[model samples]
Target: MITILMGSIAIGLSLGVLGSGGSILTVPVLAYGLGQTEKQAIASALLIVGLISSVSSFSGIRQRLVHWPLVWLFGLPGMVGTYLGAWFASFTTGIVQMTVFATVMLAAAWRMFKPSKAAPETRSEPSNWLTGFQGLLVGVLTGFVGVGGGFLIVPALVLLSGLAMRTAVATSLVIIVMNSFIGFLKYQQVLTESQTQLNWHIIMVMTAIGIAGSLTGQRLSGRLPQQKIKSAFSIFLILMAGFILYQSLPALFPAFTL
Candidate 1:
C-alpha cells in the first residue's frame, strides 16, 4: 500500500508536469506494486486517469485554452474507438498487452526526443476527416494500453492540426478525459469475478494525491522550460519502456530468460 501510494504520487506529478504520463505508469503501479492482475489494473487505471484528467481539464477550459470545435471533431470518434479497443483487450493475455504497450512507449519516447520543427505562428486547419482518423487511432491505442494517449495527441495536434504546443496540450486533456471514461465503461463489462472487487480506499487516496500533484505540476510548468521538461521526460519514458519489455517478454517466453 505504501508503495502504491508513492507510485501514485509519481504518476500524478508526471501527469501534472508533462500532461501525459500518468496513465502510462498507472498500470505498472497497480500490477507490480499492488499485486493486481493486468486486466484489473487496466480497468482501475482507466477510471483513475479519467477522473484526474477531468479535474485537470477544467483549468484549460476556464482559460479558453481548449479548442471546443476540435474537441467534438476529435473526441466523438475517439470515444467509439476506445470502446472497441477495450472490447478487444478483454481477450488478450497480460504479456501480449504489456508487450504492445512497451513498444508504444518506445515509440513515444523516440518522438519526444526528436527536436520540434513546428513554428508557433504557422497555423493550418487540418481536415475533419484527418483529425477524426488520428483521434480514432489514438483512442484505440489508449483503450488497449489504459493510457491517456496525450503523447500521441499532443504531437498530432501540433503536426497535423498546426495548433500551438500549449493549445495542443490543453486540447489533448479534453480528448483523454472522454476516451478514458468510455474505455473504463467498456472495461467494466468484461471484468472477471476477482477483478470486480477493487480497492476503492486505495483508489480514492491515489486520486486525491494525484489531483494535488497535478495542481503542483501546473504551477511548475510556469517555471520550467518546455523543451527541458520534454527532454527529461523522454529519457524517463525510454527507461520505463525498457523495464516493461524486460518484465513482460520473459513472461511471454520463459525460455528467453532461461
Candidate 2:
C-alpha cells in the first residue's frame, strides 16, 4: 500500500512537472511495483492516469488555456482507436505486449528530448477532416499503449493545430480523460477478474497522495528549468523502457541466457 502511494506520488509529480512522463512511470509502477500482469498494468494505468490528469488540468481550465474544440475533435476519434487497440492487446502475448509498449516509450522519450523546431501560433479552427484524421491516428496509438495520447497530442496540437505548449497540455488532459473512460469500458470484463489482482487499497492511497504531489509540482512548472526537467524526465523514461525490456524480453527468447 505504501509502495503504491509512493508510485502515485511519483506519477503525479512527473505529470505536473513535465506533462507527459506520467504514463511511462505508470506502466512500470503498475506492472512491477504493484505485481499486476502486463495487461492489467496497462489498463489500470489508463484509468489512474486519466483521472489524475483531469485533476491536474484544472489550472489550465481556470486560465482558459485549453483548446476545447480541438479536444473534442481529437478525443472522439481517439476513443474509437482506443477500443480497437485494447481489443488487439487482449490477444497479444505478454512478451510481445511489453516489447511493443517499451518501444513506444523510447519513441516518446526521443520526441520529448528533441522536439520539433516548429512552434505553434494562434490559428482559426482547423478543418474538420484534418482534425478527425489526426484524432484517429492518435486514438489508435492511445488504445494500443493504454495511454492518453498526450505525447502525440501535445506535439500535434503545437505543430498541426497551432496551439501553444500550455494550451496543448491542457487540451491533452481532456483527450486523456475521455479516451481512458471509453477504453476502460472496452476492458471492463477483463478488469473484473483483475480486481482480485489489483490492490484497490493502494489505488486509493496512491491517488490521494499523488494529487497533492501533482498540485505542488504544477505550481513549480513556470518557476523551474523546463528543458533541464524534460531532459531528466527523458532519462527516467529510458530507464523504464530498460526495465520493461529486462523483465519481459527474456521470457520471449527462452533459449537465450543473459
Candidate 3:
C-alpha cells in the first residue's frame, strides 16, 4: 500500500511536469508494487490516469493550448480504436499483455531519449485520413496496454497534425481522457463477468495523492530542466522495460531463456 502510494505520487508528478508518463508509472505501480494481476493493474490505471488527466487538462484549456480541429480529427477515431483494442485485450492473458506493454515502454523510452527536431510552428496540415489513422493506432495501444499513449500521441500530433509541442501536450490530454474512460468501461465489464473486484480503497487513495502531486508538478514544470529529467527518466524506462520482459518472456516460452 505504501509502495503504491509513493508510486502514484511519481505518476502524478510525471504527468504534471512532463505531460507524459502517467500510464507508464501507473501500470507498474499497481501491478508490481501492489501485486495486482495485469488485468487489475490495467483497469485501475485507466481510472487513475483518466481522472488525473481530466484534472490536468483544465489548465491546458485555460491556456488555450488545445486545437479542437485536430482533436476531432484525431480523437474520434482514437475512441473507436480504444474500444476495439480493449475488446481484444479481454481475450488475451496476463503474460501476453505485459509483454506487449514492455514493448511500449521501450518505445516511450526511445521517444524520450530522442531530442526534438520538431519545430514550434506548423509545417503542414496532414490530411484528415492520415490524422485519423495515426489516432486509431495510438488508441489501440492505449486500450490494449492500458496506457494514456501521450508519448505516442504527442509525437503524432506534432508530426502528422502539425501541432506544436505545447499544443500537442494539451491536446493529448483530452484524447487520453476520452480513450481511457471508454477503455475503463470495457475492463469494468470484464471484471463483472469474471466476478472480479477492484481495490477501490487503493484507487481512491492513489487518486487523491496523485491529484495533489499533479498540482505540485504543475508548479515545478517551468522551474525544472525538462531535457535532463527526460534523459534520466528514459534510462529508467529502459531498465524497467527490460525487467518486465525478462520476467514475462520465460513464462510465455519455456524454451526461451535470458
Q: What do the candidate models score in CA lDDT, each in turn? A: 0.83, 0.77, 0.89
**Best by the TM-score measure:** 3
Off by over 4 Å in 1: 120-124, 192-195
Whose TM-score is higher: candidate 1's or candidate 2's? 1
lDDT of 1: 0.83
- Candidate 2 worst ten-residue window by lDDT: 115-124
Model 1 per-residue lDDT tens digits across residues 136-235: 9888998888888988888888788778777887898899999999998888787853347667777788888888888778778778876777788788
lDDT of 2 at 33: 82
Per-residue lDDT for 70-155 in model 3, tens only? Answer: 88888999999988999999999989999999999998999999886575464776778988998899889888999999988888
- lDDT (Cα, 0-100) at 166 in candidate 3: 81
Q: Write the per-residue lDDT of candidate 2 for residues 68-92, one digit (tens) a residue.
A: 8887888888888888887777677
Least accurate stretch of 10 residues (summed lDDT) in model 1? 192-201
What lDDT would candidate 3 get against the real structure? 0.89
Evaluate model 2: give its lDDT. 0.77
- The C-alpha stretches of model 2 lying farther than 4 A from their native spots are 115-127, 193-197
- Which candidate's lDDT is highest? 3
Instruction: Tell me which residue pairs clash in candidate 1.
Output: none
